[model samples]
Target: MNSSNHSIWFYAVATVLSVALGFFVASHYSTSEPVYHHAQLLPQPRALPEMALVDQQGKSIGNNLWRNRWSLVFFGFTSCPDICPLELQKLASLLRLADASAKLQVVFISVDPERDTSARLREYVNFFHPDIVALSGSNTELANTANFFGAAYDRSVIIESKLFSVPAGIDMPVNAGNAYQVNHSARVFIVNPQGAYAGSFMPPFDAPQLWGDIKQLIKQ
Candidate 1:
């Protein structure tokens, strides 16, 4: 095979191995202690920027919301097909395994504000777990807040003239934007108990290691 074909074959093999390993880890990963794989901690925790985001209760929240408890913040729209709900469930499992003595919470920020109104967001997040607080706001507000965590997303509108609208939380891609897709960050940004931007946990997330590290971080 030529060099170009060799490179493609190498990547294809790597991709297949990765998918197989992910399945193996997922199937056998039981609730137990584990060593963290790729946890990145910042040199210093950064204060969140002020953004007028509304909580699940439809109350306005400022940056102060990050102050009281350690938060596992993930930026994803409710309509996300697979990763979003799986990530939140992993965070929820972390809470279940984590030391309950310390205060910890999950924050789900919607990137699709046009469809994820406060009411829509609340309903979507509540399906996972009640303690998981969902937040949504104006596009600018979301952008500002997301920037603070180095998170970014973009909506790819279908170029075709066909039009359709789907409710939030539906997995179907053919939506009101004429079959568009909103891609957002998958990293779960971690905040300290004092609500400072501590670090992040990248996927493929291992609940045991993540919660264990979070429990330790909350103590710091």
Candidate 2:
């Protein structure tokens, strides 16, 4: 073949190969993950960020506290009149349906550290179920853990509004007056045995659905 023709052919082959490689990489990266109804795997499950908090026993707690068993974690305060109670009640009911020796743990992490002392939380959790673990931490630890789970809690600082919202056990911050209240996300995060976020269940939580999902994860 002529030199000019050979050169053109070489360039064409290289261009075609480059295009193919690009398409292959794009396809691999753009593939959508499977959708799970209750608890599914993340495309890339991230480790729980470092945390240092206290448990219902006032014992130091963090990610290590979650290492051994499957944990269903909720972030709220005992003073939360409705949402927290309802969620824990549902969780208790679900646990009742499972074996007492099941390798699952329900954790209630307090967002309002100022009020949910270890003793208070211990008494509070018992009202729902004896097995439930109510956890708390310093404000910094609580904030870090919440951020890892995509939850938020901010004490209202406004002094003179007539809005009435506070956790059930907590009085409004006196310095902030009546407008201040604690606000946090209402979602339960499921952590698998590997201590990775397996999935999450948001409210309007159906006990049957949660049960089914938990069963699926257990068997897996």
Candidate 3:
């Protein structure tokens, strides 16, 4: 072949090889990484930010609370009209469906610190599941913790009829003047046993799928 022809052929061959290699790497990755039906895994685990908060028992704790066990961290408030109760119920179902050997913990962080005292959090969470850990703190502390987990909340929104909006036959014990709503993120964060932000599960969770994903991560 002429010099120019040879150069073109060489470039073409290199392009083909590059494309093939890309496909090979992608295929290998797709097969090697655990297929999660629900959870969205992060590209890499992230260290959790420092936080100073109070637990349900009025005990002072921090990010270290997530260490030593896999945690499904959720952010909400005790007075939330809908999402909080639904998610907690889902977590309760997950705990029931999970294997006894599963080293899993559910952490509920209240964003409405002014209303959701440690005592109130304790009662609210325990009503759903006894094992759930409820945490509350000052606005600064709660904001820092929520931001670290990519959660967001806004307390400025007010709904005068929020108290009356609860479904009939459902008793939601709200503190006096708790007629406002705090909009918050609905995502549930996943923390590794080492207390690192690992991944997250979006809302509308399916207990079976969530359990499957957690089981897979537990084995890893």
What lDDT does candidate 2 reach at residue 155? 62
By lDDT, the better pick of 1 and 2 is 1
Candidate 2 all-Cα RMSD: 8.9
State the weakest 10-residue window (summed lDDT) of model 2.
162-171
What number of backbone clashes does candidate 2 have, counting pairs of residues 3 or more apart or in separate chains? 5
Candidate 3 off by > 4 Å: 1-31, 157-176
The per-model lDDT (C-alpha) reads: 0.78, 0.76, 0.83
Clash count in backbone of candidate 1: 0
Error of 2 at 27 (Å): 26
Q: Per-residue lDDT tens digits of candidate 3, residues 5-110? A: 9999999999999999999999987667878887898889999877788999999997678778899999998988899999999998999898777878899988
- CA shift of 21, model 2, Å: 32
CA deviation > 4 Å runs, candidate 1: 1-36, 159-178
Better of 1 and 2 by TM-score: 1
User: On residues 20-51, what C-alpha lDDT tens digit does candidate 2 reach at each position?
Assistant: 99999888654543224566455565678767
lDDT of 1 at 102: 67
Candidate that would win on TM-score: 3
